[model samples]
Target: MDTTVSVSAEPEKKPPTLFERLLINRNYAFMWVGMATSRLGNVVFDTALLLWVATTLARNAPWSAFAVGALIFIPQIVALLMGTFAGVLVDRWDKRRTLLWMDGARIFIVLALIPASGLFHLPFPSGSDIATFFQMGCAFFILILLGCCDPFVNPALLILLYDIVPEDDLPRAFGRGQVLNNLGTIVGPPLAAGIFFTLGIQWCIFFNAASFLVSFLNFMLIRPERNAQKEEVKAEQGAKEEKKAGFVHELVEGLRFVGGNGVLIAVGVSLSLIALGAGGLNTLNLFFATDNLHATPDIYVYLDVLYGIGAIIGALTVGPWVQKKLGVMSGFCIPGIVTGLLLFTYARLDNVYAGFIVLFFVGVSQATFYVSFGPLLLKVTPRKLIGRANAVIGQLSTFAGMISIGLASVLVTSPLHNKHLTLPGFTLGPIDTIFMVVGLLALTSGIQAMATFNDYKLVDKQEETPAEKSSENEDVSQPLISYVGRPGWLSTKKRQAAICLVGFLVCLLIILPVAFIAPSSTAATVTMSYGHPATGETIEGMECASTVATRQQLRTHLTLYVNGHMAALPTGIGIVSPKQPGVRALASNGNLYCLYPLHVFEADNIIHADLPDTRTYTLGQFFSVWGQPLSRTQIADYKADAGKQLKFVVFDGKGNEINYTGDPGALSLEEHKTIVVLYNSPDVHPTPFTDWNGL
Candidate 1:
C-alpha cells in the first residue's frame, strides 16, 4: 500500500486593525489625543487671530486688505526662507522632544500676543491709527514665530507616526487624521466667532494657550524612555557626516532633487494651480456671497460648515472607496476633476443654497485629493529624503497661494475693481469673475493631473502568489512545455522528469560561460557569505557594493533595548558621501557617493542586505558595514550599566525568543528574524519585533 502525504498552506496573518491599535496601544493613544486636541485649538486660534486683525487692528484702514492679507502671506515667506534647514534639523532631532518644543514655543507666543496686541485692555486710549498699527505688528510677529514652528511640527508628526504605528496602518491613520482636522475646521470657526464677539480676544488667546499646554503635557507622558547623553557620543560619526554636508549643501540638494523629478514637478504644478484658486476664493468669497448671491454674512458662513462636513465624509468614505476601485492616483485625479467642475459651478450659482451645496462637494473633492497625496508621496519618495521632501513640497502650494492673495488684493483695487460685466442672462462682477477665472485654472490643473495619473491602475487587485510568479519565470525560459496549457504533453512521471533535466541542462549551457566571462570590475568588492570566508579577506570600511540592481536584496530587523526602552537606529551606515574629505571609497558615476553591500537607508530597524550574490548574511557582517563593534560585552560604544546584564536574543518569525550560546555576531540573519540586543535588564520579558509591516 502506497500512502501520500498532503501539505496544507498556512493562511497569511494580517496586522492589527486600526481600532485594535487605538484601544490597546499607549504610545499611539497619547499621540492621537494630543494631536486631536491641538489641531482643533490651532483652527480656533487662527480664526480668532484673523478676526481680530480684520475687525480691530485694521478697522476703517484704507489698506485693510493688505493688513489682513500680509498675515496670511508671512508664513509662506517663512517656509520659503527656512524650510530646507528645518527639514534637516527635524531629521536629526528626537521625535518626542520635537513635538514638545513645537507646542511649548507656541504656548508662550500666544500668551505674549495677548499683552503685545493690547487685548488685555491697556490703560491708554484705544483705536488710534498708531495703536492699531502696533497691534498689527505684534500679530504679524506672533505669526512669524508660529510659522517657524511648522517645519519641525509637520515632519515630526509623520516621523513619529512611523514609529508609533505599523507601516500598513499609516494610510488609515492619516485618513482618520484628515477627518478629525476637517471636523475641527467645521467647529473651530463658529466657536472662535462666538468667543471673539462675547468673551473678547484675550479669552481666545487664553484658550489657544491652554490647548497647547494640554498637548505639551500629553507629549511628556508618551512612551517613557531613557535618553542617555552618551547617545550623542555614540553618534559622533553621523554628526561628522552632517558637519561635512552642511545646511547650504543639503538646501541645494533638496532643491535639485525636487526640481529634477518629473513626478514631483507635475504634482507641484497641479497643487499650485489649485492653491491659486483656493487662495483667491478665500480672499473674495465673502463679497461673492454678500453682493452676488444677496445673502447675509452669517448665512454665507454655512458654506465652510457644509464644506467641512463634506470633507469629513470624503476622507472617511469616498477617498478610500475610490482608491480601492481605481488606485491612489484616481483618488487624487478624480477628485481634482470633480473639484474643478464644482468651482466653475460655484462661481456661476446665484442662489445661496446652491452655493452651499456646490461648496460642500468642492470640500469633498479637495479633502479626497489631500488624503490621497500622502500615500502617493510615500510611493515616489526615497526613504533617505522624506524629511527634506516633506518640508519643500508644502512650499510649492504656499508660494502659489501667497502670490494669489497678493494679486487678488491688487485686482480689486485696480481699474478692474468691482467692474460688473453684464451678459444676456448673467451679470458678472470682479469677485465672481475672478472666481470664474480661478475655476478655469482649477479645470486646467485637473486635466494636467489626469495626464500624469494615466499609468496607475486598481489598487485592490490581489497580489500574485510565489508559485504563480515561479510558473511565469519558468514560462519565460522553457519553450517545449507550456505551463499555462497542455499539461498532459508529458503524461508519464518519467517523461516529465526527463523534460525537466533537459531544460536544466539547457539553462546551465547558456549561463555557465557568461558567469565565467563576467567582468570582475563590475563590483569593487567580493562576495562574502556567512560561514564561508577566504584567508585574510577583509571588508572593513566602505569596501563592498555592486553598484547595480542585484537579483535579491534581503532585509533583517535588528532592535536594541537599553534599560527597557527601544533604541533608535542611527542612519548613514553604508553611504559614503564624496564631499567628505579623507574618506577612502570608490567613486561611482558623477563621483557623488559610494555604498556598502550591507547598509541602512534611514533610522529604522530594517537592515538592508544588498550583496553581490544571494546568501545568508550574519549580524557580524551588518556591524562591519556600520563600522561599529558588536559583542556580548559591547554595542558600538555602549556597555552594560552598573549591575546590569547584556543579553542577545534572536526571535523567529513567530515571535519566539531564543537565546543562543556563542559569539553574538555569528548569528545568521534570516528573513524578518528579529535580532534583539537587550542591555541592563535581565528579568524583563522580551518584546518581539512584531512585523516589518511590508518594509
Candidate 2:
C-alpha cells in the first residue's frame, strides 16, 4: 500500500497578535521604554553640544572649533570598537543590571560637569598676575574624559534594547524610537540656546546631565519577569560544564554571521555610502549659509528651526506611512529620493529663504530615512545577535564617517574652491560643488534602493516558515546562531586595535602641520617688565609687546627727516611721531617735540616702516638707549620722576632724537617756535607724524 497521507500544511503560524508581538510579555515594554528615554536624552544632549560648540564655545575660544569636532567624532570611534564586546557582555550578564550600570555610569559622568565648570575658570596665580591657562586646560581635559564614556554607554544601550523587544515587533519599536529621536532634535537646540543665553554654558551642561538622571530613574521602575527567569536559568546552569566563551570568540562569530548574511552585508554597505554623503553635506552647509546665500546668524537659526520642524513633521507623518505601504526597502527609497532632489535644488538656490526651504525638505528626508533604516535593521536582525549586528553596522558607519570627514576637510579647505570662482560665464564655489555631489549620491542611492525593494519582501516571507519561527510564548531567549566564527587575520581584538590605530594616524596626520605652524602664527610668549630710568624704582610688569599695533592712538608729524633735512611741524593736536623716523616725544601735559634738519623734507601723519629714506625703530629703543619694558603706570609716572631735570629729545619719523629744553606741558604756548621738518622723499614712503594728516 503506497498511499501517502496528504496533510495540508497548517497555514504558517499567522504572525502573533499585535499586543503579543510588541509587548512580548512585560519585559519588551520595559526595554522599549528604557531605550526610548535613553535615546531621547542622547539626541538632546548631542544637539546641545553641537550648538554650544558652533556658537558660544567657539566664540569664547576660536581655536576650539576643530577640537570640538574631534571630540564629537572620537566617541563614535570608541563606540564602534566596544559595541561587539558590549553585546557579548549583555548576553553573559544580567540584562537588567547591565542597563542599570550603563545608565548609572552615564549619570555620574555627566554630573562631573558641575565641578568641571568651576574648573573652567580656575585662576593660576603668578605673583600678582592670574593666567587663564589652567582654566582652559581643565575644560579640554573634561571634554576628552566625557568622550571616553560614550562608547560603553552607546553599545550597552543597544544591547539592552535587543534583550527586551521580541523579533516581530522590533521594526515598529525602532520606528517609534526614531520619532522620539526627532522630537529630541526639535527640542534640544532651542532649549540649549535659551539656557545658554540666559544662564550660560554651565546651565546647558547641567540640564543635559539632569536628563540622564531622569532616564535612569525611569529605567529603575520597570520590572521584567523574563529577566528574572533568565537569571534563574543562568543560576541553574552554574559552573559545571562551563560554556561561557571569550569576548573575541563571540565577536568573531558575530562578524562571521554578518558576512554570511547577504541582507546585513548589503545594508551595511548602503549605510556606509549614505553616511559619506551626509558627512559631505554637513561640511558644506555652513559655507553655503555664510558665503553663498549670505545668511545672517538669525537667518541661520531660522533655517535650523525649519529643518527641525520638517523632521518633526516627517517623523509624525511619513515615518509610519511609508513603513506600512512599501516595505522597508521601498520606504527607505522615498526619503532617499527626496533628499537627493532637495540637495540638488539646495545648491542652486541663491536666496536665503529659498535655502531654508530646501533645508526643511532635507530634514524631512533625513527623518524619513532614519525611520525606514532603523526599523528595517531591527526586523532583519535576530534578537540574540542584535548587539553584534548593530555593532557591525555602527563600525561600518564610523569607518565611513572617518573617511568622509577627511574628504570633506580636504575638499572644502583646498584651493580648488577656497573662494568663489568666476569662470568664463558663471561663478561657483566649493560649497556649490559639494551640494551637487551629495545630490547625485543621494539620487543614486534612491535608485539602488528601488531596484532592490523586492529583496525585503523575500526576506520577510522566508521569516514566516514554521521551522524558522521560534515559540511565540518564549521570552528572553538566545538566538539559534549564537556561535560566530573567528576569521584568522581579523580577530575582534585586532580589529579594535586597527580602528584605534587608524584613528590615531588620521588625527596625527591632520593635526601635525597645524601644530607645527601654530607657534609661528600665535603669540609665543608675553613678557612684561618695568624699571625707573632715573629713580631706580621697579614697577609692575606688563604683557610682552606684540608686533601688531592697536587702533587706539592717532599719529601726527612734528617734523620729517628725508636724508637729514627738516621742516616746521604740522598744525594738529593729534600729531604723534612714527615708530621709525619722524618720531615725536610727548610730555605728560601733551607737548610734542621732534628733531629737525635744516632742509625741506617730505613729512606726513602716517606710520610706514618701508617708506623710502625712513628709518624704523621701536618706541622704547628711540626713548632709551636700551630696550626696556614700561608699564602703563610707569609711563604715567615718567614726568613726576624726572621733574625739572628731564630734557626731552625727539626724532622725526626716523628714530633720531633732537634736543629740546622747555616746560614739558607748555608746547601749546610755543607753537610758532616748533619747527616741522620736511625732507625730499618718494611719496611711496609717506609717514604720518600727525593724526589729522590723513583726514
Best by lDDT: 1
Model 2 regions lying over 4 Å from their true place: 1-45, 56-65, 92-108, 111-140, 154-175, 226-266, 283-287, 296-305, 323-327, 350-352, 374-391, 414-417, 424-426, 449-464, 468-695
- Please write out the lDDT profile of model 1 over residues 347-367, one tens digit for every residue: 887678888889889888887
Which consecutive 10 residues in model 2 have the weakest lDDT in total? 594-603
Index of the highest-TM-score prediction = 1
lDDT of 1 at 678: 73
Give the C-alpha lDDT of model 1: 0.64
Candidate 1 lDDT trough over 10 residues, lowest sum: 520-529
What would the per-residue lDDT of candidate 2 be over residues 300-339, giving only the tens digit for each residue? 4456677878888877787778778876667777787778
User: In the order shown, what is each candidate's alpha-carbon RMSD?
Assistant: 36.0, 16.4
Question: What's model 1's TM-score?
Answer: 0.58
TM-score of 2: 0.55
